[model samples]
Target: MQQTIAAPQRDLRPLLALVATAAIGVFAWLAVSTEFGHSLAAYDPAVTTWTVRMRHGLVTAVAWPLTHLGGTLGLTLLTLAVCALLLLRGRREHALVLAGAMIGSSSLTVLLKLVFARSRPAASLLLGEPASSWAFPSGHAFNTGVFAGVLAGFVLFSTTAPARKVLAAAAACAAIVLVGLSRIYLAYHWLTDVLAGWSIALAWLCVVGVIVLTVRRRPRMLPAGGGPRAPAAGSGRPRDQA
Candidate 1:
């Protein structure tokens, strides 16, 4: 029964990979357009103004810490802690994957920033100064998107209970959305920047995930062209395996 359920999923991985590749290409073109003065994302300033206007003391209080939580230092600590927990729980593969994903996210952010060299908003409403980073894609939003998606994928794959899966998915989504909102509300990023961050993260995660799962499921072959090993004589009949 499990094989019946899983086979179709395996078959769909190539399709997923293709979709992810196409998304990455589209986003790359969008980024290039923004960088070369083609300026496809003209609404960025208006969205920034709107968010600034809607800000309040109470909301700022909430958004202030939320933004930090999605920042590099904060997310770094969280990722290390989660990696430790995963190791202690004997989930080495999961820990490695999570750490790799975060490292990739951070590296990608830096590379994109350098390539685009896009400037941040003129000012940050919260700090009264612009953040000292290139801002076409919000690093906070990008990092949080990857973090949320990886954790949610782990939970979904590890659990069989419907309610648990739903809860895990919801929590991950909430975290991603709140972090993105905090960036916009604090005037740290334009709406288009945050959207681009999320779009790229989603595309990257989907491609990496499909590749990892497919590779992990490949059947191991015996050396020297040997066939499947026979069951031990006293164990059981070979036909009983099925």
Candidate 2:
């Protein structure tokens, strides 16, 4: 006779929820401080000044394209393209998740901008045309961060190749960092503003992930007999599989 034991299952919902809560708290604090016209972080000016001083023709050339890519029009178009591709491939869940992220992030960004009414760094702006909207939380950073996170999550969850996962993770990280940096380098936003955007995106993604996982684990409806629907022949799975 051979002895056998099943591995214990671990639930990650609690951990994910905790992270989401913490990130939300951080963004709220930043928003409140900005609304009151007080600087929460002492280094905001120092970082902004350093980035302004470091701007050059070469880097500005690079940052210009990146800034546009992470802008409102660019991100909106990119999101629509990606969702269409996912839908065409029959990945309905993935498409829905990406769409929700885009809508949620955009709505929250607009609401916060209106409520906080923080002004952009007018004197430090390097663009040919100045940004006229409120800019406490950089929209470019928020949208790009959320989009990169969704892409990374899809790759990690759907792919089995370790090398591919590594590449995906690296690409996602690079996108987030470069986009955020472009905002700062162009002097359109403060460093703290970028931080708040990233924090909110993290919280939003975690919440969406939790909801999807919960729905996926929900048990199916019972048959008319009410005992349990039998598993298909040769399937060998439990009849009550969620």
For residues 68-135, could you state the per-residue lDDT of candidate 1 as single tens digits?
89999999999999999999999999999899989999999999888877877776354456677898
Full-model lDDT, candidate 1: 0.81
**lDDT of the candidates, in the order given:** 0.81, 0.84
Across 10-86, the per-residue lDDT of candidate 2 in tens digits comes to 56678889999999999988877666656675567778788887778999999989999899899989999999999
C-alpha-based local distance difference test score of model 2: 0.84
* Candidate 2's TM-score: 0.84
What are the runs in model 2 whose C-alpha is more than 4 Å off?
1-10, 32-40, 222-242
Clashing residue pairs, backbone N/CA/C < 3 A, model 1 = none
